[model samples]
Target: MSTRQEEATWTTLETFDVEVSSPSNRLYRNGRQQVEVTVKLRARNEDGRIVPLSEEQKRSVRLIDYNSGEVLPDIPASGTVATGWGTTSVRNEYEFFPGARDGMPGQIGPAEGYTFVVRYVQTVDAAPKRIGAQVRRDAQTVFKTNADNVQKSIEAVPERLPSFDERATSVEHGWESQRVVGDENDWDLRTVDYYFCGLSINGNRVKLREFTVRPASMFQWESTNPASEIFSFTGFGTPGSSMAQYNVPAAFSDRRHNPISMPSDGRGIVVLIRSNGIAQSSAGNVHKGACDVDARDEFGTDHPLRVSFKSSSNRNELVLTRR
Candidate 1:
């Protein structure tokens, strides 16, 4: 909140007049900010000397909600303090918050002007008899400006599983798991981003990109355990050299995982890949992957697909082969 002193209004009564002012005239449309309205009670004796309300007068003073037309009490404030000459006063405070009328994040339109008012009155009444006086009042026009108001802050990072385990001594070199119908909910991919973490096969880190974190669907449930696919990478930085690895979140043998797919956009998601508020890392490596796991188009066959050379036909066609 940019706490700037704003102009307020004043209402004078017989003995004491209420001084009203706000800490700000501009606020955010999010309605999270509260404008502090300070109310100070001032008194003047017949000798033209400023004085304080008596103990009885202090207790007698009341507060009213001018906006809702209702009387209020015990409004939080800087409790009464002695100024000088035994003349002291209490400073009462109130807040006026503004918000979006549409109630949605992008629904609310451009900047809008608004007016919120609050008033107070001192009153003492007895059965069938009443005496009321104004203590303090505020009727100021405040604006709900565009949201360049509040300070920017980073909340927290999204939770995700780590890419490596410290206890594991060696990589398991084996082809163990079978391809079976997997649970539609098991999207084992890098959902959160790893900044500057050298998880890339090329010794460089890549951003995972943020997306919508959605819950896996139960309707597509097929099995508790899903099958995993194995992929091998070959021919990079070596003369006629090659390497292969299966794309599995667990050990190379822990292949009981269902394949899941999620849209790059936020609309519909399949029982595959967890879009944990971010685009997950590609199946094999962040950049490189087995060509067999993902299909390709002529020249646009992502650079990773080039590593495997699964199909050399420069045609934008789909072929199905059942082994």
Candidate 2:
């Protein structure tokens, strides 16, 4: 016996309505974040009353690029099926990211706009046959610069420093006579400083607000210089909450003012550091330590600076080298 196949007919679903909603219309040009677009379909009969979508109708739903009229195969989507039989509407969500193609990073697209559409095909059953219908709605999203657009970094004037020995003098006595011998460098204490520089939109300087310093386990903030006429140190001797607050200079021309206006040459701000007073055993012995600098700009963007340094454990020995 031979079987015959007949062609199925499709009809226009005029009564059905689709609504598209996008939570955010903006995306970061750097492709660091994504925007969620949701589409909802409301099925209605000729009488204008809401009705549930059939399984075949839900299965035919797809998200497409409106400009190209092609299905979006890469954007992740969900909710093609209704939650329950009595549900009058079905919805789908698409996660759209900048520079993403087929769910992977491709060439960064132009910083412009894009349009996407949610399409649904409804299938209707007729006597001995079935009919297909389609409906669609579109959503638009645009790209913008990343929120933290100002480039942030730190340049240590001298990447390496010499730690001096604090105990350079020794005492010896012979019942009747005594002599003292040791190297007198007179410079047992030192400070390491760093400068900050970066540009904002249109080559503008970043206005620094504050500085937070977090020392490593082998190091601690120097407690000797607790306060200065230009700035005050808080949480000194405590690595966790160490911070420096600047006193608004009485005049911008004051040479002792804290560098708050970052310069293109990185000569604006100076982050000061001193040893925590951990002794070393032998001469030429080197100890390494580091601290993290968190700087807040005028835009309230936090820039991180990782600083590394070296020191000597021998007493009264100057290990820091100047540039």
Candidate 3:
């Protein structure tokens, strides 16, 4: 007779614990700046002992947007897992750009406020397991432009008719003006230039489209050569024409060439008003006029700007107010 001993076999169940670090509270609207988010994961058995994961299992870490409920394909994690008693952990670092319009690394746009989370999914023993940790509750972003305090200037040039030089002794034989012009009394051409600066949307440079300018009762428009009469430094087509149609180059939007008095380098829109026979502080001449602008952003959103101009004997002032 042989004595047989029965041995008991059991399996230890493995579980995963996830921990995440908070991200930046504020993100730039331009998407040039990024916030780093970290996620730490650990695997443990039923007996509280650390369990190491394979390379394939570690690649399952992902970053998710809680608001959109989608995995952020642009924000990929980078790090390694350490296996030890107290140091047993899988660390992942992700670069989060809140305003990234495109999923690419440097592409940016106006990103709204969103919540972020770290997620891990895997299948073990014919069962699926999903784990996630919150990285940030709420991250705020901003995108806007300031139209207040717009600077303006008025230039007056005298209009003269060409006349034959009767006094010419065959020395200067040609048509010449009667006299050198001066003061507003001799002014026939008036030019009003309105400088619009700070044209960025959420810290990102945007192209202006569908730009239309309308002048009130005081200002008069000429039917002839409307393109030359009403035009912008941004290169707009005929009045009310869309800038998108011409595909205006980005160089036109660069504010570096604008007047130094401008508030910022974000300047883009420059509207010039040209008129004839408009006198300053004259009895019949209108002193008050309103200029209305309708501009569309890259997102096809419309932003209106209202401006009023008043002229006096001493000076001329233009006030820009948001609508």
Candidate 4:
């Protein structure tokens, strides 16, 4: 038997507010107003009116503040299906406020006003979709992690790591997040990381090399920056590759679960690494990376500090050996 093929149809959905948020009338910028809006997506039908969306259209959506143009965290796609082309309404609730100033205090917003937009992204092969919305701001200012899953007890890292010229005897690991004002004028590319291992002594993983990029802004306007800085800093360990990689320490990997000797004075060496920003922080409280390894001897006593920064870079190398 022969099967018949049918033409496939595609449609674009229109986004609108459900009118289920603060401000009985519209958005205003007197102060920061908490807006709770549920954006709905639907396609056009034969009647030229809005109708339910097709199940084939898988969508991943996020929100952007109208006034400040601050992008919010992505709300993962929901209501995905393989069939039922058009039978259900697909939408998500977004909780955000308008009138946020970049460097202003949390109590105030910007003195400017502009239109807000709701953005949509579909999984199917197509460009991202967006809709314009009104944001009522009176030119005032607006503004503003799950741990415990980690098996490691995170500690503070020293501002400095052991120099490559020192003997290989101790080991440690740590990282930090830098803070900065974020906007179109902010830094985009974060530094690529590099780690190199040259000389070795008695199975010692102390000899270290490193590569680093410029730090990211600690105060992230949205959850992330649109810039390509940190997004471009991605790579994995290539086992025997002689180039820069992330998380793959040349000799540092051997230090895990291993302990070094404690000095008679009880002070040991500290190694540290810094992590880029996650683009989420308050003025005084941004993301920070720090760790101090408690290198224990046979006695299990936590005294000396050993630090190491697990950094990833594709274009830089940190030499742990003497010049």
Best by TM-score: 3
Per-residue error for 196 in candidate 3, Å, reads: 2.4
**Consecutive 10-residue window with the lowest summed lDDT within model 4:** 154-163
TM per prediction? 0.23, 0.27, 0.28, 0.17
* Residue lDDT tens for model 1, 1-323: 11111112212222222222333222222112222222334433355433443333334434333223233443233322112001112323312212222211122111221111233221121111111123332234111111221231211111111111122233221111111233434324322111010012123222212111111111111121223232221111111112112233322223222222112221111111112221132232232322221211111111111112124321111121211
lDDT of each: 0.22, 0.27, 0.29, 0.24
Report the lDDT tens digits of candidate 4 across residue range 213-316: 21211111222434322222222222132332233223323312112121112222221222233322222333223222223221111223312223333211
Ranking by lDDT: 3, 2, 4, 1
Off by over 4 Å in 2: 1-11, 15-20, 30-32, 44-50, 75-277, 280-323
Work out how many backbone clashes candidate 4 has.
46
Writing each residue's lDDT as its tens digit, candidate 2 over 77-156 gives: 33222211011123322232112323221232223211122432211111111111123221231111112211211101
Candidate 1 similarity to native, TM-score: 0.23
For candidate 1, the lDDT comes to: 0.22
Candidate 3: C-alpha RMSD to true structure equals 25.2
Which portions of model 3 miss their true places by more than 4 Å?
1-23, 26-36, 41-59, 63-194, 199-264, 275-323
What TM-score does prediction 2 earn? 0.27
**Clash count list over all predictions:** 13, 11, 1, 46
Which regions of candidate 4 deviate over 4 angstroms?
A: 1-15, 18-34, 45-51, 55-59, 67-71, 74-323
> Sorted by TM-score, highest first, which candidate order results?
3, 2, 1, 4
Pitting candidate 3 against candidate 4, the one with the higher TM-score is 3
